[model samples]
Target chain A: MGDISTEQLAEECLAIVTENAGKKKIKAGDLQKAMAAKYGDQVDRKDVKAAIKELIDSGKCVYGYFGGSSIELPHVEGSAND
Target chain B: MADDLKIPLLEELEKGPWPSFVSDIKSVADRKPMAADLLRQLEKSYEDKRGYWKHGGLVGVMGYGGGVIGRYSALPEDFPGVSHFHTVRVNQPSGWFYTTDALREIVDIWDEHGSGLFNMHGSTGDMVLLGTRTEELEPTFRALTEKGWDLGGSGSDMRTPSCCVGPARCQNACYDTMDMTYQLTQNYQDELHRPMFNYKFKMKMSGCPNDCTAAIARSDMAVIGIWKDDIKVNQEEFAKYLDDGFNVQEFVVEKCPTRCITVEGKEINIDNSNCVKCMHCINRMPKALAVGDDKGFAINIGAKAPIVEGALFGSVIVPFMKIEDGDYEELYDFIDRMWEFWDEHGTARERIGEFIERVSLATFLEGIEMEPSPKMVKAPRDNPYIFYEEYFAEEDEGEGEGEE
Candidate 1:
């Protein structure tokens, strides 16, 4: 298995959050499981975390860590202020 | 005698705090009789509410149709200066910076040709020679051009683009604004003189965040400087500001619209997390705040006088684009695209912005081959949230298949 790039990680993360839209609280474990299914041995815990960070920064995903990490698909607002 | 005689005006008690233009005119009037008579007539007109002379004619310096604006009267004897009372707009050099020699050359030329009296800067940033003759227009323009000077905007053409002193004098400048202004002015000379458009076009440029030239309000086209990176905060300087009795609670932390900055003890921390790069903090503390290394400009569109439509504020079009080598091809391409679009769809008197609003920003974007950002909206209050309706439709189709 090969190491995944940040761009690949970001795409995977976007797919996961987008796929599970409106689902009650997607967890870090769920993301890791999804990554494992897609990349098999290529994906790691650190790669998933970095990808999630990038997604949040780009306003593509919104997440809140309440003890167990839960993330959700972020809606792209029409206006910049939103 | 009473009807023929003119009144010697007395100085007013409260003529405001500023220095008197009347006095300045009087000083020049003493040296030149023609200027003296012109000033006296102007003063009389002010008192009588009637003009001493009518204005119109082709006036230039020597061999050209520009430079000196000739205000001639057929009744020249009645208005002695009327024949020679032409306003000369001396072509100001690019960036308008002058050496002592250049100043002397222009002043000497004006004094010799017509009035010693002059307005240092005219409405068009040229030196306005206030009184010359209709015939002198050609000679005056010829002489000035011969001396390596020329005419500026007069009719419906492109007005000279003025800019604040960029990298030369200002620390905040991201590019050579002055050079760019001159380049555009020189490149589009024909457009600056001919009245082809429905109305006049104005261009203005500013160095950085601080718009010294007031380009935002004054010009049809304004190029403002901006950067595209995280704000640079000097921790040591910020600490000093805090130590020097600066109001961290009120000014820095509380004043931030984004609530991005927090002060803990003497150290100030900015959560790059929320910093919008609005330059508010940088404006507050010039020494402490620096912009990010990634430099570029944000292009704004549709800023013009409210002629056809009601007054409209400029809207941000290209939020961020790189500027390099003073050769802004992207800007030129954008302008060309805008012109083509507006000229095709616009009525005789309609402006580009109004035309765009009439059509749509979406159409404009498609024409220009740029994707609409989330920031782009029809109005200021449009909803931003996007749920995948297409994806939902696909999901519904899958569910119907399961039902089958």
Candidate 2:
């Protein structure tokens, strides 16, 4: 799989975020690390960041800088739990 | 004996060659007491070196968030007539077309409810009815809206979309610029009335690369009509042009950006693909040369007034895309994506051009799913061959190695 397209990375990112949901805000850095570990050298950091932006922009997830260093998904009002 | 009311510093404004705003106001000041007081307060401010007016807390009408900018002067107790002079923006008709009856009706309404004065058309293409009281805003809005007038945008929302007169009047028009502008304005009412972003957004359209609206410099996003094919040249017209004072070598041939036009004895040949379609030839020889058949728009991004930074013209993002059926879903999606990214990340008072400057053009292109093209590159790159991100992908691939 040639770097698992940005669309695919976005899906993987969402799944990772969902699993980490309700525990705490999913850290952007941690999410990048997890994707890197899973995909090896197929994906670059910029592509991962772009994927994360796509996820947030698409409303599949919400993003905000948590504690100023890392961006995390914020809770939405009407979304079903988990 | 008006010297008693005049401040000497203001008289200096009238001494210049050009017509003075001070003098114009003075003419109106005789009949309008508020205008007299406005001049008085302005003179006092120049003397005192202070602002005579102040902005109040957010004031708006029922079910609306924008289109009214509330202003109240601190000198209300002294100049009561000029106290609550708020600005109300009424959306203008497409291509600024207005019948005499419509014009008279608006003027009559303004005369009844507002200060009789109105800006024929504001810079944002709105009919700016200046100097009205807070109490009169709703009734004025009601009267106008009842007669099918709506408000233009203000605050942090999308400002009114403006366009040049297109196929209706001009021959150079490649697309229906007026209809495009009207369609965008009508479809995006929510974006106009609702102040949801960090700053204002504006869209402007021009029928052709002539850019009558100056959309590239004045708007946040511009859809300038363009053609992808060769320039249409008329041989018969070319001969007449040659008979006249038309110097094909001095004006048209030399001015061609790509040196695409060749003029031999009684014959002119153009390399169609090499032509940049800059309209230099078309403008120089109006009868001889014309625009091509295959037409569309070149979408651009990041134009704005100099606020947080210097004024910047929007750069070409997509060189050409056909705008069919007057449908602009692609353009709208591009706008939405851009707004989503900017609204989430932009700082207060930073225009899109300034924001793009902070974030490299590469990031914006990536975010918008647009691959960088030669048209999007404004200046010559240090390495002429290395174009877009793909060129550096191999170099980026070397990044995941562990430390030695």
Candidate 3:
């Protein structure tokens, strides 16, 4: 198993972002679809959720919990958050 | 002259050989009455030696808030022409070489929604459509966007990159600078259109060392073409130069700073060991000397006017990086890496160069996964010693040999 590349992660992240483009809130399922699209049948939903958590930790992605839905990838400061 | 009764001399002195912009403004003043009135105020202020315009304002055309820049005025009714004179900077095609139809479409659109007057190109290399009303901004932007056109930088954003005529017209080009410029522009439309950074960013590309675009002095990020191999000299071409009354001794051999060339009869032998690759000799003898086969590129940073820091000329960062197929994937990744690092640490209004200087180049390079070279010095400064210093100092000992 090779180390997870940022390019692969970014591609998955972009897909997730596009699906939830206009939505006020997103969910963990969005990340699963993103990961599925990239790794096909290999990526598990749990791993996808973990990647989102990593993005949040790196300050590259943000999230919010509202109305029982987790809105991942909120705007980061000093970046094109909007 | 009374306060309001004086004609401006600066306005009258517009007719001159020194490339006066006042004359250019006056040409449009007649067609547009409002423009004429604005010019009168401008001239009056010039005569009074006072600034006619204030800096900050909100001026935009209708529809989109992002598309139209909003510039308001303290006295809107008085200076009607300039009060809400919002300019729309349309991202121009790379190299600014547009087909007849593309140009016609843009002009037609501008004529319909905004003022007929155009600035041709703006400071950020965009087509500047001046004097549009705030109400028409969104509609105009939508119309342009529908036609596959887009707005360029105005405030703090990534500005459109510009390049000189490369393989399109010049034979000396090593890469398609124009195409690369367009690709970079298109790929980063979000950065170009949106205000994401602290201050405006500028990028420029040039075909070769001729520097036809003046990228070295003007842009914050400059991509210049270079060749890594030694100079190619044609003996036959050297003979032609000599036959044409060119002084081989005085002009060619003696003029070489490194004493790299030795002209013996028709044969001009070059010592590759001593050559500095300055391109001075190639410039002098174009036909005889050519650039090497192993072509590459160099990256430069921090070239801009004095603002937060003193003016800086670009210093070479990547001394000699291979430009494989001119695809520049590595270059693109490098840019992404730079943005990731800078965007994280940079404050509002901080340029990449300023950030690098503040944090130190070593740290910046480490973040970007690049190594620092000896060429990457602090900054360009004048060296006190000249070439003959050592020779002159040792002349008393009589240890050196004379010219053979």
Candidate 4:
């Protein structure tokens, strides 16, 4: 929405997921909140969702349900989804 | 899969007077291999006296977090086809009205990668496809999405909003229940798909107090239709009903909790101010009585089953709010205020109803920035609630009196 396509936004989200992969479980809600902070608090939740969907649809990311739900890098070692 | 399989335990369930899911699954089993395996697994459960399905870890389509219920068979070594039988929840159309083509498409897709078992509508108002492998999650999602179908909520997400058939069938509906339900579902797609809250939240709408959907006893948020003006009455129709041997005492008079309706000779009169909008009079004498012209909705929050404590019926949050067809900013803003507070304070798996109980309704009201209303409570408290503002004000006044 902010002059960036959903694909580009998805790339940013992918980086956030990868960066926070080991430290914390970055959930879909967490991803939007984190990206909003990264982009000077300017991010639409719908746009973020579109980006996240692109990540999943493209097989760059995957959803894991551990108590609740969270997004993660695909095909990672010791991952539960496999 | 076998040419001749014997499921003695499951076959007994098909004998009941009520329509049986056992029979329904058997029909599906004839086509889908996984469904056949599912029947076998279920039969084993009845024989063994224990369920084989276990779910804890995550399994869903590539991007989406909700709609898929991840379940793995504990007895996978015995039944391989039903091993990773996760459930896919397809968001049902508002009022559950679906065309033949839409249903055929769903059935076709399920035949491809699913167990072919379905719940006509789950508790959360989604058309639930019972079983599928984890690997098929993406493909299943793709097929549904391509055909303009979307998934419903699950796992700490906002459950799909449901409504009784309003303008579609019932004439008592003061507001358009389907439109409101669909609008909220579409607008809150992000909240519905993701775990926005710490726990699950359910929203159910009813067109009138008859509450065919049972929104009052079940959902976290309930939108029930109401009218501000007097009940519309036709005296001639009222006489006609009574003259036709309609039992006035047993049907209309007794059914009204408030006892506002009075039968004078042949005509029935309603004390509009005292009328509670129970809709019994209107239901019994549809030709004679009707809902008022000034229509709106009565909003209630925090109704759920016993979990943290005993069951809590929804308490009225807003007595009435005009729900404009296109603009619902007031309603959305009120919900936003509630969510802001609940999201900040509620612990994991704690419901909004439980939160109100834990913090007391007074504290909950303050948290949500809602003013105290007489309509919000069933009766006056035995010991009146000591709100923070009133308590502080009393203390401040006491200081001056003490000094004197």
Candidate 5:
């Protein structure tokens, strides 16, 4: 679970975001910590942060303001998804 | 400003004893066609007792979650000028200080791109660019960012942090409020631009306890300047104040919050241990008193307006945290600890203060791993009655008796 490349982590992040698209609100910190717990210290928070950014920049995940700012599929209309 | 426009309601609004926003809006209405539409729509609202603006869906710059507040005119066919009037929130400079050139650069762009109406500031401290069309967001954003400007926070994101005029112009300043505000803005760009909290979190910094910026009431996290040592005293200046007929006993001495001051003949002695640092004495006698050399900030938490709970003033968290130049790890780490807890525990739309209230302050303190301090509470509960609980208990006891 540890020592994965940023691209790998980003893929995993996308999987988590995609899985939670309409099920629950996925925040950056929630995904970051979930990754940190799954992967060991070899996977630093910096990697998860970078991976999230990578996912966002690549248009795989878009931030939508669902009660809180959340990562969701581009067009999922969560509450006030602005 | 519109020569032939008939607006009886707006004209009546301009008739009051005070300066009117109606007049101000008209003063600049000629600059943009939208202002006339805005006035006409406002008049219709006054007549019909209903608003004509509705929030639009999902409008913002690419790759950013927050910042753009989307507004759409409900009467789009009637007011096409305001059909897509979205507000752009530009992060104001630290301490809201701006040079003439910088101010000119912003207004000049707005003059070309969107509505000429700009709020010098919003409550959250953004220079609110009031009205703009959907097509112009990127251009206006690009124009501003090209001049090294950034957007402020909106939605559930950490709204932009604001600070009082600190060491720049104030004598009572105990910390570099501007530096703290700017560094937090830069360091937490993700938090400010992205939504991670259950609700909006605000951070406000004030140079001293006079609370010129109202951080205690307005922000979720408040960093206020304070001192640890005795307030510096100028005996010569103190004597001069009395000799000049200033009423020390009637004002300063009697008004000391803790009654820590004692004036005997010409000598003034303050009980430094009990000094609450409320600044009353210092304010009354500025030349004769100065704040101590040992300065730091007091971090308070959980302040907001009435939402999901009653309003709350910030409560003390870290009584004293020394902020060194170019270093902010301690402060950010502590804030994030509380934020993480709130993110996990708070309900949707619940502010941190409301969370603290629901879970009890002790639980919140434990969750954040901070030692509970005596200073955290404003005062002990002098009225600790459990009215509703007792009433419920009595009703439970009378459950078999039948409904009264």
Candidate 6:
């Protein structure tokens, strides 16, 4: 609710992705929507995009398109069991 | 193998005055197995009265998702030259304009990398480098890209946007169609390279709707230049035409699609609102009339071949729109919204036309927030009296249900 730093925004984004890691890759739009739902437009789309860019560039996360326009992380090969 | 040759029947094709394709095939048949097999296949097709090959496969380049198409021979062993035959697309220059040096450079690249065979331009407006081996693709693309050339789209993406020569060479052009096309291509590079759509998306433009590009039938998004105001009529020219044995009533008034034009003695009158601006009269009598002051484009949508639905010509969506400030944000936004709707709801391989059919036109229009207008109707309705809602309402009231 308060003025959040880019680091905090990135961590929150990473939390969303990590929480739903096996279900689906994190969509930046969806993450922005979640942020807006919680923070009520206090967090801008630019902020969310910057957070995702940082997450990808930080090498802490892998960015890939599984399908569609929403950039989803590739499902880690050995991480999932059929 | 020459004993089983069908050269005489093939030669029979060359007996005509015009040059035959079989002659070209035969000239290279001795050295190229592909050419020989092509001739043999033609002869066999003539003999058997059927095609010899089927098509399917996913052959393309790495990293990129489009701009290459896979082709293979059903009988690979017999026609080995065309076995791994794949078509490479080099993004053509605007209006297909190129200097002599540029052409030679392209041909030189193709000679070194491909089978030295090429199609000047494919239907999608790419300089098609035909019959290239799969192994030669990366280097070929590298060489082409080094020459300031890149690939056009091929599979499941926004295939290259092309336009007619606007303002550059033609007098009828209302806007800078070439620049618009170039801007769109430059801006949508990611869309061009990706396979994100349910199927391929095409965008094409025409200057003044003579439609030299044939965008209406071939493109998903067709931008055709249009005029909103009355046509400028040259009275002197009209009088001269009448004096020179040209019947104004026979040629201009009678041929008007809307019956909006009329001739009284020497004076010609037009009902501007009823005029569809089909350019028929203008074309027939170019010297007598000219386009109006207010000119823009009529954006049409959803033209495609039959896949899930029947083949459809593009329908007018926006009757006229001004492409101002060298910015097409409105068009881009509309396309984005439409893409979002299609991306979310469309089935795999279903084009936007089929999607519009699957979900009624009303729903599709609602999704894109476009209002239906009278101009939307491409032709007169069979029964102009019946509204869709009225008919549906009557049907819902069980008018025919119990009787049936």
Best by lDDT: 5
Q: Which CAPRI quality tier does the interface of model 6 achieve?
A: incorrect
Compared with the true structure, what per-residue lDDT tens digits does model 2 show for residues B1-404? 13345657787899969988777667666666666777778888898999877653344455455677666777887777678777888888878888999999898898788766678688888998877777788899898898889999877678888888888888788888888888888888866875545677888888887788888888888788887666788988898888886788998899877787998777788986566567778888888888888777777778887765788878777666666676689778878788867765676566777778888788877776666655574421110111133354455454321100
Best to worst by DockQ, what's the order? 4, 5, 6, 3, 2, 1
Of the candidates numbered 5 and 6, which has the greater lDDT value? 5
Task: Write candidate 6's Cα lDDT for B306-330 as tens digits.
Answer: 6556777777766666777887897
What are the per-residue Cα lDDT tens digits for candidate 1 across A1-82?
2498877888877887778775655654566568878888897655775676566657676543222224556442121110
| DockQ for each numbered candidate | 0.01, 0.03, 0.04, 0.29, 0.27, 0.06
- Ranked candidates, highest TM-score first: 5, 4, 6, 2, 3, 1
The runs of at least 3 residues in candidate 5 whose Cα sits more than 4 Å from the true structure, single-residue gaps closed, are A1-51, A75-82, B378-404
Q: Is candidate 1 or candidate 3 better by lDDT?
A: 3
| DockQ, 0 to 1 scale, candidate 6 | 0.06
Over 4 Å off in model 6, which ranges? Answer: A1-82, B1-15, B26-37, B40-56, B378-404
Segments of candidate 2 deviating more than 4 angstroms: A1-82, B1-31, B379-404
- How do the residues B121-214 of candidate 3 rate in per-residue lDDT, one tens digit apiece? 7755778876566566777788888888987765555777888888798666657788878888877765664444456578888877666676
Give me the displacement of residue B155 in model 4, in angstroms.
1.4
Lowest-scoring 10 consecutive residues by lDDT in candidate 4 chain B?
B379-388
Single out the weakest 10-residue window by summed lDDT for candidate 1 chain B: B379-388
lDDT of 4 by residue, B29-132 (tens): 66677777888888999999999877735677655678888787787778787877889999999999999999999999988878877888888799999888
Ranking by lDDT: 5, 4, 2, 6, 3, 1
**Which candidate should be chosen as best, given TM-score against the real structure?**
5
What level of docking quality does candidate 3 show?
A: incorrect
Each prediction's Cα RMSD? 23.8, 12.0, 11.4, 7.3, 9.8, 9.6
Local accuracy of candidate 5 as per-residue lDDT tens digits, B286-313: 9999988878778778888886678887
Judge candidate 6 at residue A59 and give its lDDT. 53
